[model samples]
Target: MKKVAILQSNYIPWKGYFDMIAAVDEFILYDDMQYTRRDWRNRNQIKTPQGGQWLTVPVKAKGKFDQSIRQTEIDGDEWRDLHWKALSLNYRRARYFSEVVEFIEPLYQNSYRTISELNRAFIEALCVYLEITTKISNSWDYQLIEGKTERLSNLCQQAGATQYISGPSAKDYIDPNIFSDAGIALTWFNYEGYPEYPQLWGDFSHGVSILDLLFNCGKDSPNYMRFVKK
Candidate 1:
């Protein structure tokens, strides 16, 4: 059965995001929707020795009140250098830091005009680093319909999905009736049962960037995540 998951692109999302991606056959980046302020769309937390800190991508959202994620532009080029420096400082002492630094450093060097593009680039890169083979695409590529749950169901239909899996946070917004009517099975993704890994901070945090798990676990990262080897 073909399973699909649709979610907005997040800046260096947590391990749970990749867990959802790994559980599905196809993953869709739903960025055609309106962009929300202070959301995972443009920023994420990273573990530090002291605590977890947010690394945000400053976007030009001053005049454009109703900007879509695809249309949201980076405020300036300086954020890249600053973010790279922060990551280097925080994760430099991670167990597998040296192994993955080469692959991740280039992402900061390159410039992306939009937040969606930058997020997608990092997501795809991290997926490769974790060996996830799920097909990824942008939502604009599909024929969008109206309504909250309807739009998601339509996207699943467009992708020829027999089952639609989503994060538990959408339980309030998603209507099982919609997916049922579409002959699609709906399942809520669970983020429970994640074991603590060797982390730098005093408290182990699972909500930081996937990079945290990668830097700490290296080639054994997938074993820490829900992704199962075939």
Candidate 2:
């Protein structure tokens, strides 16, 4: 059976995010959904000497509040250098910092016009390091129908998916009956039980970006994550 998962693209998302991607056969970037401010779409947390710090990518979300994630434009190019510098300073001493930097640093240097592009670029690159070979696609690539559950179920059907894998948070609004009606089996991805690796900071946090795991564990990063095979 073909397993599918759909989620909005995130900026250097946490390890759990990649875990969900790795658990599915086809991962869809649901950027067609409306963009919300102060969300994972533009920023993610990172560990620092003091505590967890947020590295936000400034986006133009003032007046155009109804824009989709794919349509969202970045405010400026200045945040790029600031984010890269912050990561460099905080993770410079990580065990695999130098090894991961060879690929991670250049992502910050390249220019991306939209958040979707930036998020996808980083997600694809990180997947390579983790050895995840799931097929990634965009929501707009398929014909979208009406209703929340109907749209998701329809996407699965269009993609020839027999099973749908979703995050637990979606249980608040996702109607499983919709998938049942479409002859698709629904499964909830568990993000628990992640083992802690040798983190640099004083405290261990699983909510930070996947970069933390990569910087600390390098190729062995998969050992600390769920779904990804070591």
Return the top candidate by TM-score. 2
What is candidate 2's lDDT per residue for 119-185, written digit by digit as tens? 9999999998889999999999999999999999999999999999999999999999999999999
Candidate 1 to truth, TM: 0.98
155 in model 2: Cα distance from truth in Å? 0.5
> Local error of candidate 1 at 47, Å?
1.6
Q: What number of clashing residue pairs does each candidate have, in the order they appear? A: 0, 0
lDDT of each: 0.91, 0.94
Q: How well does candidate 1 score on lDDT at residue 61?
A: 94
Q: Give residue 189's error in model 1 in angstroms.
A: 0.3
- Runs of candidate 2 with Cα error greater than 4 angstroms are 228-230
